[model samples]
Target: MSPLISSFRIAIAAGVLSLFALPAGAAELSKELSTAVTHAGLAAGSPDLKMVQTHLHHVVNCLVGPAGAGFDSGQANPCKDQGTGAIPDAPADKQKLLLTAAALAQGGLAETDLAKAQAAATATQAAIKGAE
Candidate 1:
């Protein structure tokens, strides 16, 4: 298989594995995080519009999913401005995503960066009341 195809497959597999790694009972948090991890995996393997878009959505969701889902952190909501939801629809958001995708496509993110992103997601989820 071509390198792209191989990378895509690897990304897909990584997503599936992430789901199994999550602890039970945090269904809501886990779902979004799993999706984000999946998208990140895809970008790491091979960047593309779809993968990057999805990656941003999930990453943002990871940071804001609890608030969007109404977890009520009490201190201050991370995704309060999100209102109903947050999708990368704005022109600027799109451009940023495209740029990120291109950069990732050129060369996947560093392992440390990926790990930091993953850790951020976990911390964000923990911040939400009842999300952990």
Candidate 2:
């Protein structure tokens, strides 16, 4: 192979490999917050209390991340690759908003009534959006 062709191939190969090499916790905090918002909206729109609780749990899980307090291991994290956790990864100012969203999500999880859970979910979504 010609030297120039070999150099081009090496560069192309390096670029391709770099595409898959995302650093640990490289996902932006906004992505996780948005994911939390999505789950919260889903919870708010749920037709039943059980589904509301389920989606709320997802919101909490995403906000808190795997290592954060209130993170539930049993619930699926919709923001798994989107950052460590929205609350922990957020900047100081935005952390407060995420924390509020987390509290609302936790509250929604504790509620037994469908209306209250839905309300909490709506509030949680709003709080997360506030950080944006």
Candidate 3:
């Protein structure tokens, strides 16, 4: 194989292996989060209701739920008003993502923070795609 092709293949292999290394709960959460953010990014790119809703849903189910992957962070949920997850003061973008996710799960998808959520979701989706 050409060196470039070999390197690309190796990188892909590494990424796949890394994904497999996540524990079951964490893997599920990551997969759900990645999928939700990808969907959100495609909806409107910014302040998109679809994106916000999807992100929120996944966040609650995967990160905030009792069986969630929240344990992976070893930190309380920063976005939670009174619980543990990431931390309340995580990066602004990250905070938006987590807060929106929580809100979506909490049935409070207000329009006020949709922009932030959209940005967070889009950025996260971009990062995941870049990894691929």
lDDT of 2 by residue, 12-82 (tens): 99999998985554356767877888899999999999999999999999988899999889989898877
The C-alpha TM-scores of every prediction are 0.27, 0.79, 0.31
Q: Candidate 3: count the clashes.
A: 9
| Rank list by lDDT | 2, 3, 1
- At residue 30, give the lDDT of candidate 3: 48
Error of 3 at 23 (Å): 2.3
Q: In candidate 3, what are the lDDT values of residues 1-132, reduced to their tens digit?
A: 899999999999999998769555444444544554454455325355755654444444333434444322332222233223332323345545555454443442344466655655555454434322
Per lDDT, the best of the predicted structures is 2
Q: Give the whole-model CA lDDT for all candidates, comma-separated.
A: 0.39, 0.88, 0.46
Q: Kindly list the per-residue Cα lDDT of model 1 for residues 8-124, writing each as its tens digit.
A: 999999999997873443343344334444444544343344443344344444333453432234323333333322222223423343333323322322223554444433333
Clashing pairs in 1: none
Model 1 misplaced stretches (Cα beyond 4 Å): 1-25, 48-54, 66-132
Give the Å shift of residue 87 in candidate 1. 17
